[model samples]
Target: MAGARVTTGSRLGVRIREVPVPADLDAPDAWLLRGQVDTVNEVEIALRGNRDMCRNPHETLGSMREQRYTTKIRLVAVDEDRPGDAADPARVLGHAALHLPRQDNTHTGEVDLGVRPAARRRGIGSALHDAALEVARVHGRTMLTTTTQQTSEPTDGPLALAPSTGSGRLHRDDPGVRFALTRGWSLEQVSRYSVLDVPLPADVLAAHRAAAQAVAGPDVRVVLWESRCPDEWVDQFALLQTRMSTDVPHGGIARHADVWDAARVRTIEQQFLDQGLGYLVAAAEHVPTRTLVAFTALAATPVTDEFVFQNDTLVMREHRGRRLGMLVKTANLQRLAAERPAVQRVGTWNAEENAHMLAINVALGFRPAGGTGEWQRDL
Candidate 1:
């Protein structure tokens, strides 16, 4: 059970305490706990002006509760009779996940907050975030993390169009980045967003398809995903994710690799479905003498009628060449266009020097979206 203690701050009288483990999670607490993304959306909106830029981030069911259970998450209740009754009971004023030992620490707990907009200027966020810090401190974690985008970048800024949950303006950075600054979190990393516009010429697409098909031979297969997921694909998807952990240029992630599990992958999928994900493909090619050689995917998100996000695309190491990457990209585009015909552009990112990925992206029409350093602090 949560060990309640008296604490005073902001306009609300509140009992800040540790949230109990799974056993004591009541229905309301459980429900509220499950609403992390909602809290996140509100928190993000309150900080950044745009509210429709973070949709479809994960693809798992009941992902929020599962994450809280897994991450050492906490919930702080504002006592109605206490000093901050002006704050809404339902608002998750602060939230911080443990910065358990991992590959990186520049951004960890204190990175994201979920406070209600109306509760701003009150000490709720600080208290909640500070409470998050307590969770990290007890665990021996040193870094408190957070970030907000730069508002003045450009209409064609690096980020691909992402959907935020509430009705808000677009292209505005949240003030939460300020929260990180005040709390001592510094700019640790920045990645550019790149895109491919002006569709590939019909001749070019046709030639690329033919080349990929010829390279793979008759047994090699590339399958396009429809709206609903199929049963046979789940395990395959998980296997592909294992490869992703090491492949991405995430040199500063704070969570340890051992912490990853099938549940995490499932949650990402659940979050994606909740946010309206679009287009996917799984590729496998039968090499000569019956060897199966390649696999990859091209996934994207629609920003507006004219823009789509080519989020993260990956090709298995052993199957790097042989056109499997191209096959998946072509397939994703074909499927995306068919399902959402009006999308006219696509964007993506890759480490500045990753030649292979850059080659593939360039071939398909992606251009540089700037680059940000992936700096981190040893917390």
Candidate 2:
């Protein structure tokens, strides 16, 4: 039912259509893609005060092409009532993305929905959610996952709703929270969203790196690269990604280990490059075996010089105590400062229950900004 149009009986005459993936940036309908990205960023900024989580339109399109996951994009628009009402005949109000993993976690699908701030209370979000649910059911997905962001933790009162993890709470009165609760979704876990001001003092970073190196000993060394992974370490890097899927604290979220290999790794790398993103990776090598025992990645888009994102940072379970996490993170941050000095901030998210990683982030001077609630529903 891709591209099928459905009109709703609202004052604005809202229409929801499944968007087809464009061939390139110059495609005729590419404006819809840009509109989707704009809507999401607008909603995020309205909720959290910063558009740190905004995705480049090129990246979103490239991700849509990945074989490992099937992503369906849907856009909600309002029909113009007058001939000269607006520049665009259909003004985009919001969008929804339903992601179905092809390999592991086949029974689970992820639904991400957002509505423009000025367009809320118009039943647009509920319409998009209902469409996503129908699509998930059609795909035979038994479980669905989504998230809601809040700028601050709600006080412990009647309006607060705590997750089963019991670590963080979200305000029950929040529109997103209320939307999910009334639909049978449960708050599974809360994740702390943090930001670190970049270009930290050179001496401070040097001291942290030196100390971590001492603890890691001579047996472990760090290797840094940009854009692509060298052939020698590609296999090991893939293994770490596979481990990351299961090793991270999920906290009651129904998910399974994601399988990754060298080919999948290479595909994503190429996608990132095509999306105009600059990514740097630092991996800790076990000198004896010459395997990547830990790794961390930092990425930024040239569209914005002031911000970068902290991607996955995973240290193998067996290599946890040697401060390798700190070692790789510091190495990457130092490199980021040297290569992309324009970046003034780095943003990241971690499960609130993951104390070890949280402690590491805290030591790096990252401060809490906001948090997200992982919501799940079993159909």
Candidate 3:
């Protein structure tokens, strides 16, 4: 139960309260969760011209239950006068989530904050940020990281702010960008958001896969699976995941290697299943060694047929020269098209500095859709 509410400066009578996670979507307080889903979807649509990133209420609740290095706290800004029901889209003026990693990087916290378009300039966002900051301080977190989305790269000028990486820029006037800058946050890195319209010509996918296989040589083979990892390959998959933590480009964002093991991998897979989401994984196996060397994954919810998210793509250091990245990615894309034909578009994010992977994406027909800035602040 949410115990207390603090009113903000907005004349809309907006109040901030900690939302309690319900046992299940059917719980009475589930209305709060539904309101959160509505608020997030509206915000994404307003910013990106689409709601492809929105999670359904069930998926939102499931994320709260994840115990793998994550403890989630959500705060919602609600209008006192127009406290609408579960069906109301604008009931929640804005919301913020603080994710505290328990196993590692305890000194750091991740924040996700958003406000409805019509409700901006009303102090709702500031109230939520203040509430999140206080909670983070109480938990002993010294650093905070958040992300802002931009639909286009900002040109070199007074209104554009370049990240420390110097590879991408964001408009200084974007509400999220301005909010973070005013709060002492610094731009750390920028990630390019790309989208690929799926169901590529069968011949195109086959040719790409064939070319990658030839470059990878006869010593490596691709293995595909849906939902859970096969018991035989789970441990090797875990090792690839651990490598994924440190192998990627992280710019100036403070982060530690996320340790992963067989058990942890299974836990994450189960979480995805419980959330009513389906995922596809394609791993490159070195035939001689009989071990998984590289992997990539894609996930989608049944809620929408138009969008799917390309989660992670990593090739082990020693395995890099052989084009395993292209092999696993092309293999998975083919599988995704066959298994989830309704998914018309695949969305993915890559660090602007990650040239190799971006090149592969470009060849696969993914065009730049937008960019996201990873911002950090030390408390």
Candidate 4:
């Protein structure tokens, strides 16, 4: 993970240096981690306001560390500073991260950047973006991508307009989106982040389950598991994961189906277990073929049971149009409520153009909380 340093002296006198490890949650490194987290938090709050969409990563740092992913963090500072420099306090004006995949999807690299609210237009973000781009190039990545929360009408009419003078006021009007567009990045897709307030009426849950059961017919059975997938069904789960990439609507983003095997599935399952995270998996199995046709999962951290993230939900192409998607999602939500009673809300993301999946989510009482734009540049 060694690379030449990327530094830029400009509008506000800032430098970008790589942060190799951002795992330590206490003391010295904790301060550095806070600087990085605070800047991103400030930006999110400014854009999303009091919405539940704003993310606070102060406690999730350790859990994010995974052996299978390569992530480099770069801090934009005022003084002559580097990672782990004990002499001077790092005046982190902004920060950026370059994420590269180790196991698969090696051709694409992700760039995450943020600037403090007080230091918005001083070229700090530019420096960090340039540094991340160079690092991606050095790592032999051809595609650079990022996602941003934007405040605008989530409609095709406004989205179709290119970045130009006097355009509507969107979060895109911010420095981050302008910087990406000026640097040759294209808007690939738009996605909506939906939130579902939990503990719906008893009747609602019973009705959803009844509807799913009726749609599933007698041939399809619902299955639930916690944490790890059973050994016998590992291959079936991997196949479904591989199909998710192509089956899900990605809009214009160029992404190949992920290469997943039994080993990869096990690796991920173990990761969640090690992090003390609770997982709920619900799948719809076709009794006649004795195969899993649809599946959904929810990830909840034991440290805080206030919220759970909807991981993934997929139904095989041949098995669609039978309400399996809703069935699996509802079944998993029921399992989460029963097993992890502390969860108050669940969050999920879907491409704006994915009407089918969106319809299912709306049916289950999920509402749009915010929107995200997927930006990309091909090198």
User: Which candidate tops lDDT?
Assistant: 3
Candidate 2 residue-wise lDDT, 63-116, digit = tens: 666655554545545443425534352377878888888778889988888988
Clashes of each: 37, 0, 0, 0
| Model 4 score (lDDT) | 0.72
Give, for candidate 1, the lowest lDDT window spanning 10 residues: 161-170
TM-score of 4: 0.85
Off by over 4 Å in 1: 1-39, 43-61, 67-69, 72-111, 114-125, 137-148, 151-188, 194-220, 226-237, 252-279, 289-311, 321-323, 340-349, 352-379
Please give the CA lDDT of all the candidate structures.
Answer: 0.51, 0.84, 0.87, 0.72
Which portions of model 2 show Cα errors greater than 4 Å?
Answer: 2-10, 78-90
Cα lDDT of model 3 by residue, 94-170, tens digit: 88989998877899989999988898887788888988888899899999999999898877999988889998889
How close is every model to the real structure, measured as TM-score?
Answer: 0.60, 0.94, 0.95, 0.85
- The ten-residue window of minimal lDDT in model 4 covers 161-170
Q: Identify the candidate with maximal TM-score.
A: 3
Give Cα distance to truth, residue 63, candidate 4, Å.
5.0
Q: Which digits, one per residue and each the tens of the lDDT, describe model 1 over residues 239-353? A: 6656565655553435433334455556656655554555465556353434323444444443334566665566667666667777767766666656666666676655534
For residue 112, give model 1's deviation from the true position in Å.
2.4
TM-score of 1: 0.60
User: What ordering of candidates by lDDT runs from best to worst?
Assistant: 3, 2, 4, 1
